[model samples]
Target chain A: MKRIAYPAAIQALIGELKRLPGIGPRSAERIALWMLQSRDARPLEVSRVIREVQESIHACPRCGFFTTDTLCEICADTTRDAAQICVVEQPTDILPLERTGVFLGRYHALGGRISPLDHVGPEELRIDALIERIKAEAPSEIILALGSDVEGEATANYLATLLRELPVTVTRLAQGLPAGGGLEQADELTLSRALAGRTAVKG
Target chain B: MKRIAYPAAIQALIGELKRLPGIGPRSAERIALWMLQSRDARPLEVSRVIREVQESIHACPRCGFFTTDTLCEICADTTRDAAQICVVEQPTDILPLERTGVFLGRYHALGGRISPLDHVGPEELRIDALIERIKAEAPSEIILALGSDVEGEATANYLATLLRELPVTVTRLAQGLPAGGGLEQADELTLSRALAGRTAVKG
Candidate 1:
C-alpha cells in the first residue's frame, strides 16, 4: 500500500503505464507524478478519463481494434473498396500505410497470430469472422498484412489453406523487409519490400 | 480533442499527464489506453479519490509538509526531538535523509525555493510558516536540507538572516554537491560533500 492517499490511484496509473511495451514501474510512477503536478488534477478530471475509457471503449465489432463505435472508420467507409481486405494485428499499424494513401480498401484486425506456446492461437483470433466476411463480401483479394515471423507465416499459411476453395485470391505480404518486426515498427523500405514481394499462392 | 466519447475527459487526462513534470502526448495516450483496458476504474472511484485528497491532504498546520490531519507525522511523533526542524523544499525530499536514519527530529517543507526568474520568491513559498514554526518550536538547530542551487542558497541565506537574533543554529545541508544536481540522482560521494562542507551561517 502507498504511504500516501493517492497511492492506489497512482499505483493504478503506473500499472496502466507498465502495460505499454517499453514502460516499467519507475517510468509509470514518474508519469503519474507528472500528471499530478498541475492544480487541476484535484478535479480527478484526469483520473475520470482513465476510468471512463475503462468503462466505455471496446474492440471494433468488425476489426478488433479499440473503438468506441460498433465499427471503425475504416470499416464504415463505403467509398473504400470492400473487395480487398488488408489484414493487420494492431490499429497503430494502419496509420503509416494510410499516410501513403496507396491502398484503398477495408481491413480485418486479427487480435494476434498463432503462438500456441504463448497461448495465442486461431481460436483467440477473429479468423472465423474473416472467413465469414470473405464468404459474404467475396473480396477480390485478401492481403495478408501480418509480420514475416513464424507466427505470422503460420497464420497466413493456415488462412490460405482454409480459403483455398474460395474464389478470392490468397496472398502473403512481400518479403525482404524483415522477418520478425511488427507492421507498426517496420521501416518504409522493409514495408515496401514486403509489399512488392507479395506473391500469389496455389491456394 | 480526442475524437472519442467524452472528449473533454480524454482531453483532461492528456492535459493532466502533460502537466506532469515530464510526460508527453504519446505517453498520455498510452496511459489513457491502459485505463480503458479494464472496467474496475469507476467514475466514482476516480472522482472520490481526487475530492478526498483535495479536502484531506493539506500542509501540516505546523511543518508545511503533507498531513492527513492538522499536524504531519513528523510533527506529531512525540518521541522525536522538537528542537530541530529540518527544512526542505518538497515532501518527497525528506525521504532520502529519512532512509539514512541519521536525523531524529521534525521537518518543514518550504514548498519551494526563492527563484526570482520564475517569480517564486519568499512570499510565494512557505517561508513565513517556516519562520513561524521556528519561533513556535524553538528548535536548537535548523538544518536547511534544500537543493544545492542558487535558489536554495538564497533561501537558506535569507532564513539565516531572519533567525540571526534568535539563539539557534541555522545550518545548511551542505554545498559541494554541485549546482543543478538533485540529491536523488547524486552519488554517495557527492552527497557526503554537501554534508562535510556545511559551515556556520555568517548571518
Candidate 2:
C-alpha cells in the first residue's frame, strides 16, 4: 500500500522544480512539499506572476530595457536627458546605474555580447537597432556599460564603428570595473569609478 | 523601437523557468529560450514524464521511499527480508543506504525528526505507523539511519523507547558520522562507519 498520498499535479510541479539550477531531486521534493503545504500561499501565484510578466513584458522601444508597456519607463521619461543613453548587455545591468543616481537618461540592451565561438555576431545583438536610434534620436553621447570580457570589448568595438557614422560622442565605462565582471555584480564603488573615468572612444 | 522579437507563448515558458532555485531572471530567460528552441524534442513529453510521475507517484507504504505503485520495489521485493526495516527521517536518506547496499530489506521514511524549534514532533512524522508496522511484521531489528545531529539523536531516542515495548531489537547507526553531519551529505566512508557500527539501544 502506498504511504503518503500525492496527486499527479503536485508531482508534475516537483519534476519541473528539479530542472531548475541548484535544485536536486531531493531539494525539489522539499520545495514541492513546502509549496503544497503552503498551497494557500499558492505557488501557482509565482507561476501566475511569471505569466503576468511574460504577457505584459516588452523591451523599451528606444532602449532595450524590459517594461510592461511599449517603451521602457526610462526611455518614456521626457525629463531625462534626450542626448545621452547608457548601453549595457542586459536589463538587469540597469539596476546599479539606477541606484547610483548618476546617469539621468536612457539605456540600450545589446541582448548579448558578440562571441564568434558562440556564433553570436553584431547582427545578433541590438547594434542595428542602436544605430537606428542614434540616427533618429541624435543623442549627444552613448555611454557603453558593456562587460570587460573579450566578447563585450568586441561588441563595444563593433558598436563604436557602427556609430562613427553618427555625429555623436561614443564612450566606454572607464577601467574601474574588474575585467570580466558583469555589471550586475559590480559594487557601487566600482560602478562609480567606471562611470567617473568613462573615456570617449576615438573614432 | 524594440530590436528583438520572440513569440509570446515562448516568453511564458521563460517566466516559469525563472521561478526555480538558482535560476536568476537572466538565466531564466536563457533557459526559456533554450527550451523553446528545443520544442520539437517533445517538450510536453518531458512534461508528460513529469505529469505521469506526478499523477502516479506514490511513496512506499511500509518505508517512505518514492514509488509508482502500491509498494516501493524494495518494499515489495519478496526476496528481501521483511524481518528488518531501516529507518530514516527523510526520503533522501535512502540514497546513501542504497549506495552501501549493505543491508538487504526495506526502509521506513519517518518524514523527519522531532525538532521542537521547527514545531516538528513525532506526531508530525510517520512514527505511529512505524510502530504499527513493527508490531504487525515483528521485524528482527530496527536500524535507525538518522543523522548524528541533536534532533536526529532525539528522534532515535524517542523511537527506541517506542520500539522497546515490542519483542524486536532496536539499534541506531553509530555516531561515526561527525557531529552535525547529515546522512544526505555524509561521505561513503562516514556512512559506512555508522552503518557498520550500528549498536543496540540499551534503553
Candidate 3:
C-alpha cells in the first residue's frame, strides 16, 4: 500500500529519532509531529539542549564518567575515600550503585567491558587508565561492581590477573539470589550460588 | 544515596529528554549519554534534523495535514477523488487508512473531536473549515473515519446531525470483527456487530 508521504525534513527527523533506543517508527513519527506542532518553542529548546550537551559533555580525564568540566564531580571531591575505588562497566552503572549508598569510595567507569565477540578488548576500554589510577592513588581495595554476564566476568578476571602482583586487593560482587527473590523463581544456578555463598548468622 | 552528579549540560539534556512520551528517567539518561558518547557526529545530525523539521513543516491550509508547501502531498495529487472526503479526528489517523488502499478520496482532518469532558466543542475543531470545503466542493459523500471510542462516536453523531441538512450523503467506518481476526478471540460486542452487519454470501 502507498504510504502518505511526509515532508523530507519531517521524515529525516523521524528517521534520526528512530535510531535512539526504545524508539520505533511509530514513536519517532509521533514525537517528530508533536515537536513540530508544539505551541511553545519546544523543538528549538530540545535542539539547543542536544547540541549543548554534545558540545560540553565528555569523559572525565581521570575516570571514564561523563563531565562538562575537565574532571568529573566524584574525581574533584576530596572528601570521598581516596583509598577505595569501585570499578564499573559503564558510566550508567555508577548511578544504581550510588543509589544503594553502600559504598563510600569514588568510582572508575571502564567505558565498557571486554567483549571478544563484539571485537572489543581491554584496549577499547579504560583498563589502562584504571591501572594508572591504582598506581597513583594506591587504593587499598578495588571493588569490581560489574554485571554477572560473561563479558563482565571476563573483564573482572582479566583485571584480577593483571593486578595479581600489584599492592591493592581486588574483589568482585557476590553472586547469589537477589533481594526479596522467591526460591521458586530462583534459577538452579542462582540457588546453587546462594547456597555456596551463604554466610554464618550471628547468635 | 549520594548520586554521581552529571555535568549541568548533560543533566539539563536528560531533564528535557524525560519530557518526551514513554521516556522515563533511566531512558532519558541512557539516551543523553549515548548521544554524548557517540563516536560519529550523530548528536549534531539529530539536532540539525530537529531544527529543520521545526522550521519547514506547517499545517496544510486546505486539509490541516503537515506540509512544507502550501498543500500536503495528498491534496496536491490530481489522481485522488476530490468529490469524496474522508474525515478524521487527527492528522495521524490519515496514514493507517492510506495503508489500506481502500479509498482514493481527499481527507479533512478535524484536528480533534468534540469532548465536553475536556471542554472541547465543535468550535475548537476544524469544523468550520470542513463545512466551507463541503459547501465549495459539494462532495457526493463524506466518510467519518474516526476511532471507536466514546469521543469519536459523539463527534461522528454530531457531524451526522450537522450535515443532515446539507446536500451530500454521510457515512462512517463499518463496525465488526477486524480482518484476519479469529471468531474465538472476538469480543462479544464485536461479534454482535459483525453478525448485525453481515453481508449475503454469493454462490
Candidate 4:
C-alpha cells in the first residue's frame, strides 16, 4: 500500500515547527496536530504574537537587549548605576541576572562569543558597540558574566585584553560551588575552582 | 530593583507558546526570542501556514481523519479494503499504523476513549459512527487498535458489546511483549499475557 501523508498545510506547519531550537520531527508533528485540533486556536494566537514581536522588537543600539522603542528598558532607566556594566554572551542571559536583584547596573549583550570553529570572531559580535559604550559612559567597573566553557573563556580573555588599556577595572564572575548545591554533586573542575577561589569568612 | 520583563509583544508570544503541549515558561521564552530574532522570518511563515490549515482542514465526514477536501485520502481511496475497518482512538494514531504498511484496511477514529475521571464517556467518542459504518458497509472485521490502558480497554469492551448485534467480527490488537523488548524489561502483566497468548511455531 502507498504511504499515508498529512495534508500539505499540516506538513508545512510541521516543517516550520521543526526549525525551533529543541523541537524534533515527532515533536513538530505532535505540536502541528495540536495546533490543528486544539479548541481555542492557541497556535494561531501564538503565530500572531510572533509576528507582532518580530515587527515591534529590535535590539537596543547600545546594549543589544530586545526593545520596542529607542532603547531597551534597562538602557532607558536613569536610576540604574551608570558606573557599572555587566557583560554577558547573549540577550537572554540578562533576565536571570536581573532576577537575582543583586545587580542594579546596566547590561551589555555580546550577541555571541568568539568561536573560531563556528567562524564567530570579535568582528561578528557586539564587541565594538560595547567598547564604544564603555569609552563614552566611562563605567568604573566592567563585570564579565559569561559561561565557563572554552568559547566563553576565550571571549572573556579577548575582551579583558582589549579593555586592559582602558581606565575601568575589569572583573569576571567568581567560579565556585553553586548555592544549594552539595560538594558531592560538583564536578572535579568546579571543585578545584571553588577551592582556588575560596573567600575568607569574617566573623 | 524592579523585576525586568520582556516587551509586551514578546511576553504575549511567550504566553501563547506556553499553551502548546510540551512548551514551558523558559522554552516559550526561548522560542519567542528566536521568532523575534531569526533572520529568515520562518515563524511568520509558520503563522501563515497555521491560518491556512485552520481555514482549509477539517475532519473527514466519513473517517474523521484531517482532510482539506470532503473526504480524507484514506476514505477517498478506492483500492483500500472497505470490508475490514480498523478502529483507533485518535486521528493521530492512524499515521503510525499506516507507516507500518501492514494493514491495507481503511480506519475509523473514535477521537478519544472512555475516561470517567476526565468526564469523557462513550457518547463523547465516535462509537455511534463506527456502528453506523459497520451497518452500512457490512465489514467482515473491526480491529480495535486502542491503547492498553484501563480507559482503552473499557472502550474496546463497550464497542465489542455494542457491535455484537451487527454481523461483524470484532478483534483487538494482540497484547504481548513489544517487538525488540526483552523478557527482563517486560512487566508482570505483559509477561503473563505473553505466556497466555503464545503462538504455535508452524516451522
Predicted structure with the largest TM-score when compared to the true one: 3
Clashing pairs in 1: A34-B20, A34-B21, A35-B20, A174-A194, A174-A198, B83-B139
lDDT of each: 0.70, 0.73, 0.88, 0.90
Please give me the DockQ of candidate 3 compared with the native complex. Answer: 0.55
Cα lDDT tens digits for candidate 2, B87-184 = 98887677668767687767899988999999999899999899899888888999998988789989999999887888988887765777787889
TM-score of each: 0.77, 0.67, 0.88, 0.86
Per-residue C-alpha lDDT of model 2 across residues A1-203, encoded as one tens digit per residue: 22323445556767776775455788777766655334252355444544454455566666766666777667767788888889998766775688777788788888889999999977888888888888888899999999877888888898888788789999987678777899999988779878988878999
lDDT of 2 at A12: 70
Give the C-alpha miss distance for residue A128 in model 4, angstroms.
Answer: 3.1
Question: Clashing residue pairs in candidate 2, if any?
Answer: A8-B54, A8-B55, A11-B54, A61-B1, B64-B109
What are the clashing pairs of model 4? Answer: none
Residues A1-203 of candidate 3 have per-residue lDDT tens digits of 24587778988999999999778898898888789667788778889999998887787888778787888888887878898899998887877877787788889999889998999999999888888999999999999999888898899999999989899999888999899999999999899988999999999
Error of 2 at A126 (Å): 1.9
DockQ of each: 0.29, 0.10, 0.55, 0.59
Which 10 consecutive positions of candidate 1 chain B have the poorest summed lDDT? B1-10
> Which regions of candidate 2 are displaced past 4 Å?
A1-56, A176-203, B1-58, B177-203
Residue A178, candidate 3: C-alpha displacement in angstroms: 2.4
Stretches of model 4 off by over 4 angstroms after superposition: A180-203, B180-203
Ten contiguous residues with the weakest lDDT in model 3 chain A: A1-10
Q: What level of docking quality does candidate 4 show?
A: medium
Each model: TM-score of chain B?
0.75, 0.77, 0.94, 0.95
Q: How accurate is candidate 3 locally (lDDT)?
A: 0.88
Cα lDDT of model 4 by residue, A1-203, tens digit? 57899998889989988989888898888899998778786766777887788788989988989899999999999999999999999898898999898999999999989999999999999998888999999999999999999999999999999999999999999999999899899999999999999999997
